[model samples]
Target chain A: MQDSEDYLRKKAFFDSLLTIYGRKPVLEALQDESIPAYKLHLAQSNRDDSVVRAIRDAADKRNIEINLCDRKALSRISRNAKQDQGVALDLALPHYGTADSFLNSLPASFELLALDGITNPQNLGMIIRSACAGGIDGILLPQKGCAQVDPLVIKSSVGTVFKTRILRCKTLHDTLARFREAGTEVIGLSSHAKRTLSDIGGSGCRIFVLGNETHGVSDAVSRISDSSVRIPMQNQVESLNVAVTAALIAFRKQL
Target chain B: MQDSEDYLRKKAFFDSLLTIYGRKPVLEALQDESIPAYKLHLAQSNRDDSVVRAIRDAADKRNIEINLCDRKALSRISRNAKQDQGVALDLALPHYGTADSFLNSLPASFELLALDGITNPQNLGMIIRSACAGGIDGILLPQKGCAQVDPLVIKSSVGTVFKTRILRCKTLHDTLARFREAGTEVIGLSSHAKRTLSDIGGSGCRIFVLGNETHGVSDAVSRISDSSVRIPMQNQVESLNVAVTAALIAFRKQL
Candidate 1:
């Protein structure tokens, strides 16, 4: 019960952050003091037109620091410099940071969706919404070889990205290794497994490792999984979308 | 057993159709005579650019009928005349037609996905892919409020559009009426139903009704449904994506 309460508080903390991009959107967000503004990024090349100047003035009044970033740096932060309109803002999300921290703080009985090679931003966003709605404990999202967290993902998620329990990691392999060390059974979702989910047959804390759209779970992640289970399906269909599969598992009553 | 055999033959026939759009792509498809071509729609305003000329020439070589349509007519057929580049080709798909006819021919037992007010083409495409992969008997897609079959939907379906069994309806209300008259249980997949899927027990000739992304199953259709069931979800997540819900229901193990 204590862990559940802590999870709610942590989720509330992350949900408060609003990362808005684009000059006009950021300006609007900044002008509204109710909207929390953590850090503002501006392209160094921005000529500070009247609108830009007004943005800087608003930030000055709010005591929000403006970081003039090089083109590459701004693009890195904004993800889409063309649409960023020479500006971006990152609101605070104290609870959403390192996967290691989140995993270490786990209450021992929880469900996690560890993704591998999910490249489409839309799929990533939809997955986040489903995971959050399905009440998964936390999402272990690897930074590399996956779609970067950006505005498109946010749009696709319908703003659920901020509310979802996101635990960022350098790589999922290391996180899975640690979870294994802590005695958590890692299960890879595959359509080919002889055993169906019913075979797992118990109320146990599990990390459901999802994989690429075309390929099943990565070999490295599967190698560490205690076993693999398939969703019993008809129609000779091979598999469901990673996000759909995630929804099914996250909401599975007996899981 | 005979009905199953008939269903297989009907599916095989529908799998042959290939709807190709765009001037360049149509030309390429026409050039490969091995590829099927039912009809070619071309805008009357086409100025015969070298590309347009090539498309016309390729169609000519393939003995494919060319319908010189006005801008409005072309746009209606292509759905997006701007991107269609004044050209669209309809390949043969004899089995995919009126939902009324499909319902009339049902074999007393089947699984169908009856969609209500699904407008997003991507969602429509994804649903088709999942339905096809999960081996649904047929998809009852109403023409009035649902997303029209288009290039975006095709791309999102990853070309599974051709192989899937699609039953087009003039309006979902009328279609639901017909299904009810035929003794098919119209099962609405809502998030609020007291009867979880497990509580519903065995399925028999179920047409799982999937609703809009936001509004959910329309009232008219829900009234017609014999009973409504829900995929028991976790946390407070109200619902899964319409496509994902379809996948869960369409592929649900006893269905």
Candidate 2:
């Protein structure tokens, strides 16, 4: 019983940690007083430049733990040797949490933007930005098929990834099924859907599932969707980018 | 006067050619009979693969010329040595033309999507896909300060770049000025605009100008715009992705 409890505590600690790499991003995170940083990592081989100096100064001022390791160790920690620029930072973002916790914290009537099989980091980041800007209650991002919250995603999101409420799950299909069981309407965007997005109104707890860029919503996920709606294309043109579709869904009410 | 006339003739001839590289894209072009082929280029170092054989077969069936050159020559033709994969094709797209020609061909009460300082190739491609799918009459793409119609853009557009009507301009500011002169309603999107996009209806020839990714609409472009509109954003989120914004504008009628 004690071992199981310790394992759960360790898992929770790792789950709460979000590691972001790159010199400029590390410096920016250090400068931001609101960001709760756990540790600052640097490579011993890093050249002493003004940016590096600023990063060190900021981290010292913030009183964050600093670890100076070899290049290989830094790479292992950052997980992106090429673009990490020999620096990485671990931040415990308050807005990031699991789907269960998010569901427990939600109001009676809320909306969420869920992603399935979205592999492009830039697209994932842009979708997060749209969801945040449009005031979607939470973003349901699967830990499996969807893109990870990497540096590219952070860059494309323009730092909104840190600010947005992200609900993580192991698989989108399973989590969507759970939401449906909880009396939430799971809506998928499809080209062949009979009704348009504007047709969807008077929602209770709702989850909008955006699919892959090419193949679209997986068949298993579609089966569980309460209903489907399309954005209504014209001129015989097929579809919009997945990110654009997410934006349309995010700002559907405003429109 | 004769020398100037020759120069103009040559310029028009070169302007009509759209070159796309990479083996798969070239092979796809060869397969599509609707795409007018000008020439096919291949590198001598290329292995005899099934795709290359299919490309040659398709080109031969279509009576297109094939030039097998050195690696250097192939790279020169493709202009992308790293990703060209030893193949290139020149296509005479019917949908591509200059701003002046596009203006001459415009119908009354039409909508055009104009891009200003959109540097991301992926964003430009997604914008083209949205514009084409949403049935926007024309896309006013300033040749300067915008991502070119490169392989990346073509990939992101998912072949809609060939189908969409593209209006190439030397600069967006100059083209918007000309559109204003022609009594067209030039509208710019901004976060600070007093009006929302839905407020502007019953347009007789409208052009919606989207600005740079970081900066909203440029000052010069804003000066020429008859009016400006904003997309309502919530949750203190500053803006949406440029491509997402384009999709919103493109599909606003349906919304």
Cα misplacement distance, residue A196 of candidate 2 (Å): 2.3
TM-score per candidate: 0.74, 0.86
lDDT of 1 by residue, A7-73 (tens): 9887756554545687766776678775567888888899969989989999999999999989889
Q: Which residue pairs clash within candidate 1? A: A235-B135
**Candidate 2: tens digits of C-alpha lDDT, residues A94-194:** 88888977766567999998888999998898888888887788899898988999888988887888888889989988888888888899999899999
Cα error, candidate 1, residue A254 (Å): 6.1
Quantify how close model 1 is to the true structure by its C-alpha RMSD in Å.
7.8
Q: TM-score of chain A for each candidate?
A: 0.78, 0.91
Off by over 4 Å in 1: A1-20, A23-81, A86-89, A231-236, B1-20, B23-89, B191-194, B230-232
Angstrom error at residue A131, model 2: 1.2
True contacts kept of each: 0.40, 0.80
DockQ of predicted model 1: 0.31
Task: Considering the two chains of model 1, state its CAPRI-style docking category.
Answer: acceptable
- Lowest summed lDDT across 10 adjacent residues in model 2 chain B is found at B101-110
Which candidate tops DockQ?
A: 2
